[model samples]
Target: MTQFASLLLLKTVLLSGLALWLSVVVVNNLTAFRGGVFSVGSMMAMQLFDQAPAISTPLLSRRVTSEGWHRLVYGFVVIVEIVVALLLVYAALASLGAFLGYADATAAIGYANLALAGFVAMGLIMLVGGAWFAYYIRQEGAQITHFALIGLGLAAGLVINIPTP
Candidate 1:
């Protein structure tokens, strides 16, 4: 395969991976995100409120309480995830189509946008939802590592999407 084709394939893989991973996260955390009858979205919200330390010490600095705002934040999170996942999935399919000779160079550029869109949303989740809301602290810094790795993956995909001479 040509270098261009290889790059397209790489972008396809990256976008598809992100899409699949997002779907998995949502499915795995249904109790925390779903709006269904049995869903415990409120519990997840309570968890969010609990993260905010009552007494703001010199170490942790600021704390946020989302008692009544949990569902709203959870909804926002779900919406962002849904939108980004759809974009990634579409981009992956487009990238694959381009790889198979169905599209031109412009499709390659679209892949970068698709990846960036998802990654930017994810960055918001990491920074705003995780760091600002202290999800990392409450969850033992669990998602921090995943967030960094996803950033790296998005960067790699973006780098490869740059046009070559």
Candidate 2:
């Protein structure tokens, strides 16, 4: 195969890997529903930073202590995860088809654009949610992870959009 074909294959593999990761996330969230909810609830409630000597601010007042709201937010997160996973899976398959000469690059890139957009949207949603609840104060690791995801999604989007020679 030529270099261009190799690049196409690489793009497909990357997209597939991302899709697989998202699938695992959805499965883990569903399988450990209570645990996932607890984690989110803990962040929302600012459990870790409530009395910590670290930067104390009135932002703690924004904490969501209601269990019902926790569950609702967790449900919404899962739904978005599922939707993004499906889009990525479809994009990966289309990319594979393009690589294998069964489809054109335009179709693959179109699906990839949609999938990558979803992926970045997920990252943005997490960033906004975490910021709203002041997760960055004590949950810097999670914030970093979300930023990394957004960066990877943006990089992959650029790769997928590169014109073929």
Candidate 3:
């Protein structure tokens, strides 16, 4: 089709790919934490939830250990997944804005760049958490897999941020 339509399609594909990747990472991390391993990723993920208590006195009031910690970790994973999904939606809108020429290229780039950064950060968090979970589960075998997924996410984010030719 037209050049604009082609660009729009590329944007859609990138955002959808990002969302799908993040969802897979979240699900796999959770599953491994609950059933497979308790590696470093699991511990790191748990730490994110642990920090919430320090930032908020109310969360601190609630106990955070054992089963409590498990729930907290799971919650954090879910939250991260939700944020990734939202970012993908925003990415689509930003792409549409760009394709329609309703917004400047700079603005479109900014939105995509911001979303990419956010995804990368989230992916890092997921990696750490997944590693910790694997450690806890005593499944050191899965550490490499977790790292691979993180790497994939980072690479995808970087590719999406590249300026269109």
Task: For candidate 1, list the clashing residue pairs, or say none.
Answer: none
lDDT of 2 by residue, 126-160 (tens): 99999999898899999999999999999999998
| Highest-scoring model, lDDT | 2
- Residue 122 local lDDT, model 3: 65
- lDDT at 106 for candidate 1? 79
User: Could you tell me the C-alpha RMSD of candidate 1 in Å?
Assistant: 4.7
- What is the Cα-based lDDT of residue 61 in candidate 3? 35
Off by over 4 Å in 2: none
What TM-score number comes out for model 3?
A: 0.59
TM-score (all chains, Cα) for each model: 0.69, 0.96, 0.59
Off by over 4 Å in 3: 1-8, 20-65, 133-142
Q: What tens-digit string does per-residue lDDT give for candidate 3 at 1-165? A: 776557656766777677666667666766666552333333543444444343333333333346555656666766766776677667767776777777665565566666666766665775675543434243344556656656765775565566665
Higher-TM-score candidate of 1 and 2: 2
CA lDDT, candidate 2, residue 19 = 97
